[model samples]
Target: MYYSRKRQPDDLPQEVTAIWSCTNEECNGWMRDNFAFSAQPRCVQCNSLMEKGERKLSILENTSPNHSKKK
Candidate 1:
């Protein structure tokens, strides 16, 4: 008889925080979330392109390091 090991599911990456803002400067809307490694998110208020603002290195917290670096 041959024995085989079971395969386990891949672990999720560390929660990276980001702030998404609306492309329309007039709206100037924004939001924040613990973005997963495999998910695409958009602005909740204006439904505009969500740009990656900044990254948070702590748990249970949301920080925007590049709030002024919008593209």
Candidate 2:
């Protein structure tokens, strides 16, 4: 008997928005704007100031109770 499995892609909404990328060329790190704390967020990996840019990424869901809608 033989078995095989195929990798599946993530299920998320795609959109173009601001992003934070590490200034260090050696480190490859980034984050979405909506999830950032300030206008300019620093790279958590290398503690370097991140650069602002635009990119297409999956929509991150907001499941926090603090962000829940009123009834």
Candidate 3:
């Protein structure tokens, strides 16, 4: 039996999403804005300040009851 591990294009739906990107050039850390716990989030990896940005990313919903979304 041959099994392919690769994901097909239709498997993931992408959208231009709001995100927080690390201000530090050395850090490649980023996260979806909707999932961020704060208005201004810090990089989880480097603890550096983050800036608002957008990227073409796979659509994912945050279903955790405790997770709040504040604009």
Candidate 4:
């Protein structure tokens, strides 16, 4: 007998966070908010402006050494 099922990774994350959505009419692009460095970000796919939005995605850790902090 042989197995036919694929095994899932053990490091799967369980959380949701904000993201940026592309405003392009014919493009489907989005990015994590934490990775953004500006108040308003442009879509990397079509260079269109992005809007704030929420999505249910796996948790991600931000490890940027030059991360800016707001008082």
Candidate 5:
């Protein structure tokens, strides 16, 4: 007999948007999504520290098999 393990899910993907903004309260500036995953992000308008915003799951598409038990 052989044994096997199931694979685990990976980290959730970051939010993808066409536009963004700086996180610095003092320097509220608008930014773009081109620099989302980069180590450093600066607000082009105010050159302030920027952080990715919370992800919003607007679209839902199930890729897993329907495993619901029949009644």
Candidate 6:
């Protein structure tokens, strides 16, 4: 089986957004701040406590009508 090795254009708009990073060093769990519904979010992957941070991610509009503004 052969697969194309060409680098495809992934030019999506990027933004430095707020995020939650897991405090557990072994866990690599994180989430976009705007998408989080709670003042503090637990890692969905490891259920560990998370801290505030920033990351460069492809801009995404959180269109979930039920989402609440915590910050």
Per lDDT, the best of the predicted structures is 3
Worst 10 residues of 1 by lDDT: 62-71
Models 1 onward score TM values of 0.38, 0.66, 0.83, 0.76, 0.34, 0.79
Question: Residue 15 lDDT in model 3?
Answer: 97
All candidates' lDDT scores?
Answer: 0.53, 0.78, 0.93, 0.85, 0.54, 0.87
After superposition, which runs of candidate 4 have C-alpha atoms over 4 Å from their true positions?
A: 1-11, 69-71
Residues 1-71, candidate 4: write the lDDT tens digits.
Answer: 99766645555666778899999989999988888888899998999999999998877777898766443
**Pairs that clash in candidate 6:** none
Identify the superior model by lDDT, candidate 3 or candidate 6. 3
What value does the lDDT take at residue 26 in candidate 1? 63
Instruction: Report clash pairs, candidate 1.
Output: none
Q: What is the lDDT of residue 6 in candidate 2?
A: 52
Model 1 C-alpha lDDT per residue in residues 1-71, reported as the tens digit of each score: 99767543333344466656567776776555443222456566676666657554344442555333323
Candidate 5 global CA lDDT score: 0.54
> In angstroms, how far off is 27's CA in candidate 5?
2.6
CA shift of 10, model 4, Å: 8.9
Per TM-score, the best of the predicted structures is 3
1-71 per-residue lDDT for model 5 (tens digits): 99767533343444454446687787767644443444466777677877665444333333436432223
Higher-TM-score candidate of 4 and 5: 4
Residue 1, candidate 6: Cα error in Å is 16
Return the lDDT, model 3, position 11.
Answer: 88
What does candidate 6's lDDT look like per residue over 1-71, in tens digits?
99987745476768899999999999998999988868889999899999999998888888788977655
Ranking by TM-score: 3, 6, 4, 2, 1, 5
Off by over 4 Å in 2: 1-11, 63-71
Native-to-model Cα distance after best TM-score fit, residue 44 in candidate 4, in Å: 1.1
lDDT of 2: 0.78
Which run of 10 residues does model 4 get worst, by summed lDDT?
A: 5-14
